[model samples]
Target: MQKQSKKGFTLVEIMIVVVIIGLLAAMAIPAFQKVRAASQKSAITNNLRQLASAADQYFLEYGIETITSAKLADADVGYLKAFKAVATESYPTDIESGTDIEATDVPTAVSADNTLTIDF
Candidate 1:
């Protein structure tokens, strides 16, 4: 009688494949988290830039030193739409030292150089 080759993978072969997949997943998860964090940081940066730009415009229009979050979000001026509906609260702080930028986290106001600075 002639011997026929087996068509299916052996137990060891299947285990090796599973281990490879597991290794790939383990490596991928952290990388994905990093990308997500980077994306969040970018969004926070954009938002801060928008806020600072609005503050600058408000200062130019009203000639005020300290511009709160309220006047910027005012519909008549429409300098910024960042803070609305949450009403009568303060502007969030901006910091760049976290895995994600929470709603409460935002950078300080425009600096003396007229640029937003991210606190680390």
Candidate 2:
């Protein structure tokens, strides 16, 4: 009689592998999500800085201290145009609201009481 060799993984071995993979994936997923959220928050901060700079330039040129959504809609300024474009149809209504920007308080770019804060 010829002896047979085992060519396939046993059921217990397969189950162990599946469980290990599941645990690794569960551990990695939450870390990835946290990193992604931080990156998004950083992007929002950079976007706000750009918008604030543009708004400052606009104010200097037009003698206005604020840039409303309506004004941004009407103007052809590069920063406003970029903000609208980057925001993708939902322009930020409050610069300091922390609704989308992900920050707790208004960024240093704008005043604390300012409502139309440049959000993400």
Candidate 3:
């Protein structure tokens, strides 16, 4: 008689591996989400800074105190070549000096009330 050898993992071993994988996933998911949210916030902040810089440049060149986001982001006559949104958010139509710019309807990942504001 010839002895037979098991070539694969047993059922219990497979179940243990699955449970370990599940636990690792459970531990990793929330951290990944937090990092993603932080990254989004940073991107949004950078966009706001770019907008503010363009606005400042426009002010210095044109001697204007107020400008629309659209005007700043314009291609032909605007300081910025183009403005990009990082997430689901809205930019102010009218941006003025000494006033803050706010992005509304931001994703829940970034904020609780779905809004982000930055001072210019």
| Per-residue alpha-carbon lDDT of candidate 3 for residues 40-82, written as tens digits (9 for 90 to 100) | 9998888888888888888889897999888887778758767
Name the runs in model 1 displaced over 4 angstroms: 1-9, 83-120
Runs off by more than 4 Å, candidate 2: 69-75, 80-120
lDDT for position 118 in model 1: 40
Task: For candidate 2, give the lDDT of residue 32.
Answer: 90
Better of 2 and 3 by lDDT: 3
* Winning candidate number (TM-score): 3
TM-score preference between candidates 1 and 2, better one: 2
Assess candidate 2 and give its TM-score to the true structure. 0.62
lDDT string, candidate 1, 33-104, tens digits = 667655544665666556777766766777766655566676887988854312112344432222132234
Measured by lDDT, the strongest candidate is 3
Ranking by TM-score: 3, 2, 1
Cα lDDT tens digits, model 2, 13-103, are: 9999999999999999989966765554456567666655555666678875455544543555554654432222133443322233223
Q: What is the C-alpha lDDT of each candidate?
A: 0.56, 0.53, 0.86
lDDT of 2 at 6: 75
Cα deviation of 67, candidate 2, in Å: 2.7
Instruction: Give me the displacement of residue 20 in model 1, in angstroms.
Output: 0.8
